[model samples]
Target: MKKSIIVSTLILSSSLTFAFDLSAIAKNVVENVTKEQTTTQETSTSNLSDTTVSNGLKEALKTGVNYAVTQLGSNNGYLNNTAVKIPLPDNLAKAETLIRSIGGDKMADNLINSMNTAASKAAPKTAEVFVEAIDKMTLTDAQAILSGGNDAATNYFKANTSDSLKKLITPIIQETMKENQVASYYDTANNLYKSNVKGLVDNSGVMGLAKNFGVDSFIPGSSDESLDEYITTKAIDGLFTMIGQKEAAIRANPLEQTSSILKEVFGK
Candidate 1:
């Protein structure tokens, strides 16, 4: 009876070992499959996310530039905005005051008004320049801009486009002033003011006349060249400033994600 019990115990032990080995094999298979699936899912999600973010940033920047240009193109856009208004600078101010003081006030005011009008009209053209700049921006540039500070994109855009924009805008502004009668106004104010401020000193003494002319540089020259230059410069500055502001707004408070691509990319 004792011999029979020992043999039975040994058979049971062998069966238990086999059952434990089978369970271990099953667990190992499940764990390996789980790990592979997890890795694959993670990689897929990451790729999707990267694609979305890239597309979203590009759309956002384009929208921002468009918005800025639209606002700047409106009436009184440059004239009404003190931050970007094209006012007569120091050299032209003296001439303006001299002319106005001498009963050429209407012409003086007209010149100033025309300068503002020309700037306002030309404001709309800046959008094209900005758009071109956007086209030139690379994928890497877009990525950096996306993660950069609020004005980083604008600054980047400006760095790339300022000289080109200025070149295009200068001629437009000059032409606008000429076509709108501001050119005549500038000429009249400068000529009249020059006589009043410097003409008297021309024969009085060379030293005194030179000094007076230096002081009169702030006035409208007996011509509109200085005023034209001043207005054009100011108009360009205003255009860029508005663009920068719009870019900053986009960076700080982006609009709703309009596309799955945008959502996927910007979700980060």
Candidate 2:
């Protein structure tokens, strides 16, 4: 009877010890898990601090702006690029058609070429404006742009620099157009049409002839858009479009991360 009691006591003691060990193990496991979670959270928060985010966004914008300027500020940049090619304005379309139909196609072509040339000449000036605008970007703006969609940076620049860009680009365009004699060509064409052609064609008779020939009729002095204004507006729009493309490329391609900050922020 004493042996049985002693054996029972040992067995009960062993059971209590085992239960205590299991409780301690469970407590250790919970503590370890909590620590790991806290460390991970801290690391994530540290990685995306305000300065990092802001700098990363600014770097991306600078890359985009520089790439766009390099691509568009070269010879034949606007003339060869169909996407941003400055065609005759809509108001001048009829004038171009008229000139073309009368074997003055070279003159019309010259006008179009001059417009594109002026835009190309004015493109280099944009880099200065873009850099200035980028320098003025606030941290809040950077955060908003980084969290926004692919074109967010481009949109931000457009919104902030539109007025400044217009003011900066307009005079350059005007100077280039003047050098190219864009206004002179248009005025010459208008004067020629008015002096030599208008008296020869009866308006109703010409309309009838145009209807019979299934060709759109033409008129001169109808275009309200000034050449300088049209070229300046189109040039700025094209630059923005190019910048947007660059921004998207950087956002989507890890290889485009040119700097350490970009690699850290956008590499994800």
Candidate 3:
């Protein structure tokens, strides 16, 4: 009887120990599975948020660029729009004013109109340039713009597109300027204004100081290069100006969010 009791006690103890080990193994498995699932969920959420922000940024930029290009590409687009009209260089402002006062107003007007017209003619060609930049934008770039100030999107575009914009737009601007006889008009305005000035530019003493300093180089010219550069710069500036306006409007006014992506993007 004693032997049998001892055997029974050993069997019970072994069974209890086995049961405990099985319980521990089952608990560890359940805990590991739960942890893995939680990690996967967090990673997926992070990836989804980044993708959403990236897509929203691209759509917003495209929307703003298209609208700006369309508006500035239309007839009298730059000439009639005071905000974007191409003016004679600041150096020519005094000359233009004096020229107008002396009845050469039509001469100055023609030059300004021609320059603005050339810009308008070249505006349509840049839509693709901007679109390409937007397409190539990275997720990191989109994140920066999202957290940046009101002009964030515009700043991003300016940094990325300005150089290429100048390159691509220069030839088109040159062609349009030639078609418009911009050089001839520029010459007429320059000559008429110079004759009328006859060194009156020294009245303010700024011109005399420039001459004294041998800095005649400070004066702007009407050479083909100057004309082309000046007009190209103005065109790009005007484009970004329009872009900034649209971006700001979309940020500040819900009505300006024209697309669902834009609404969701800016709404955030």
RMSD of each: 13.7, 10.1, 14.4
Candidate that would win on TM-score: 2
Clashing pairs in 2: none
In model 1, which runs have C-alpha deviations exceeding 4 angstroms?
1-51, 94-105, 180-228, 254-268
* Reference-based TM-score of each model: 0.59, 0.72, 0.68
Give candidate 2's TM-score.
0.72
**In candidate 3, what are the lDDT values of residues 1-268, reduced to their tens digit?**
9999999999999999999999999999999999998898666545556788789778877878887898899998888877888888766654676577779788778778878888888899999989999999999999898779878888888899999999988998788777666465665656655665545665768777877887665454433346778899999999998877777787778898877877666665
TM-score of decoy 1: 0.59
Q: Model-by-model lDDT, in order?
A: 0.67, 0.80, 0.80
What is the model-wide C-alpha lDDT for candidate 2? 0.80
Clashes of each: 12, 0, 0
lDDT of 2 by residue, 77-179 (tens): 8888878888887757766867787897877778888888878877888888898888899998988898898878878988988888889889887777776
For model 3 the TM-score comes to: 0.68
Model 2 scores worst on lDDT over the 10 consecutive residues at 216-225
lDDT of 1 at 11: 87
